[model samples]
Target: MKKENLRQTSEKVWGACALAVKAHALAKKGARLESHRDLWVYKNEIAREIGDWVKIVFKLADSMHKNFYENLTTREDVLKE
Candidate 1:
């Protein structure tokens, strides 16, 4: 991918991950249930959301890394006139 495109993609991914984390934190803080079962359910929901976000982050990171390495090896091709 082009440098600008890559930059934009990474920025979006990072922003999404950051937002997910923020949401998880807010959910934890807002969990005011007194019952153990309710708390457990709330925690599970938050954890699942966080986990999905984490997966997205990891996948994006991996894609970025792979793209970087592949592009590096093909630098000469990119520079060809």
Candidate 2:
């Protein structure tokens, strides 16, 4: 049961991290939104992304194992940057 919960949590967090990256890309131009609609949408997406990230953090902390964070990123991925 513990293992299952950890797996689910890991997947959720990984998905949320992808979302954060998407939001970051969208925000690269700064928040100087031109139209009212544009600003509203941008704020909406940012809020949702932030909320999901916080939820994932708390969930991970709840049942996190000692080595749960170990080796999360691959050496090749890091080297690609």
Candidate 3:
């Protein structure tokens, strides 16, 4: 994908991750969460509590966010899975 499109797509992924983290934190602590990293860090618990697929999706979203800035993800990498 083009860099501009990648950025836009990554932003949308980041937004979804932020919302997911917010809902997770609110459910667990009744407070707001700051980072998408939390989801990956707690993937085991998330998988056990939510589902394995949720954890995988969160990880993918985080990767997309990182890729936007680092420019390390290729279209083939995205399409691989």
Candidate 4:
């Protein structure tokens, strides 16, 4: 793999990890807010936000892995700057 590709993959993995941590924290708070109606609404909003972030992280990870494998087979770097 090219150095650039490796660096990009590292950055993406780091970003995904950070997002996961944030989502986990939000989920914890959301769980805690389950009993209060007003707080539950806020918790639901936070849950939705966490879902969106998880989707983004999954997309990024999937794209990166797919491109990495494709590059391995085709020797063509697909992640353009």
Candidate 5:
């Protein structure tokens, strides 16, 4: 059981890291958003209110990567994000 729990934890952490990487790729390749101002650039280029949430996803991915390394985030905290 302990081994299984460790495996699950490891998998979750890796998944979070992957998510962060993918988000970065999307921002860099899809929108070319490299800096904070670039976020606005993407938003303006799209001209859609819903595109704002794309920024949130990028931020959340970053937070998840940090939380994964620190091991300070709970499953509930991630779910809320």
Candidate 6:
């Protein structure tokens, strides 16, 4: 693989990992919020929103990975002469 392509792949992988970690942190926060009755309703709502956001983030990460693999597979076909 070309150096630029390798670099791009590495960046994408790192970005995905970072996003996953963020999602995990948000999930933990959401769970913590659920433990407090005074803030339960509001916090639960926020947690639900965070859950949705995490799903979207993971979907984006999945797309990035899929695109990276597709690009790798078709590198020769897709590259400019």
Candidate 6 residue-pair clash tally: 0
Candidate 1: segments with Cα more than 4 A from true spot: 1-4, 30-81
- Per-residue lDDT tens digits for candidate 3, residues 1-81, read 456476557657766876876777678768655654565565556578878897778778778778778877666655452
lDDT (CA) for every model shown? 0.47, 0.45, 0.68, 0.47, 0.53, 0.46
Q: Please give the range of 10 consecutive residues that has the lowest summed lDDT in model 4.
A: 72-81
Per-residue lDDT tens digits of candidate 5, residues 19-74?
Answer: 54446548756634455445435544443544666556655655665664676666
| Model 5: how far residue 16 lies from native, Å | 7.4
Q: Which stretches of candidate 4 lie over 4 Å from their true place?
A: 7-49, 72-81
Candidate 6 per-residue lDDT, tens place, 1-81, comes to 456574356346546544545445467654332222323243334447566664454444444455565554344422321
User: How do the candidates rank by lDDT, highest first?
Assistant: 3, 5, 4, 1, 6, 2
Clashing pairs in 1: none
TM-score, prediction 4: 0.33
**Per-residue alpha-carbon lDDT of model 4 for 1-81, expressed as tens digits?**
455566457446545544554455467664332222433244335548656665454445445555544544222423441
Query: Which of the two candidates, 2 or 4, achieves a greater lDDT against the reference?
Result: 4
TM-score of each: 0.36, 0.30, 0.65, 0.33, 0.42, 0.36
Weakest ten-residue segment in model 2 by summed lDDT: 58-67
The candidate, 3 or 5, that scores higher on lDDT is 3
- TM-score-based ranking: 3, 5, 1, 6, 4, 2
The true-versus-predicted C-alpha distance at residue 21 of model 3, in Å, is 2.0
Residue 15 of model 5, lDDT score: 62
lDDT of 4: 0.47
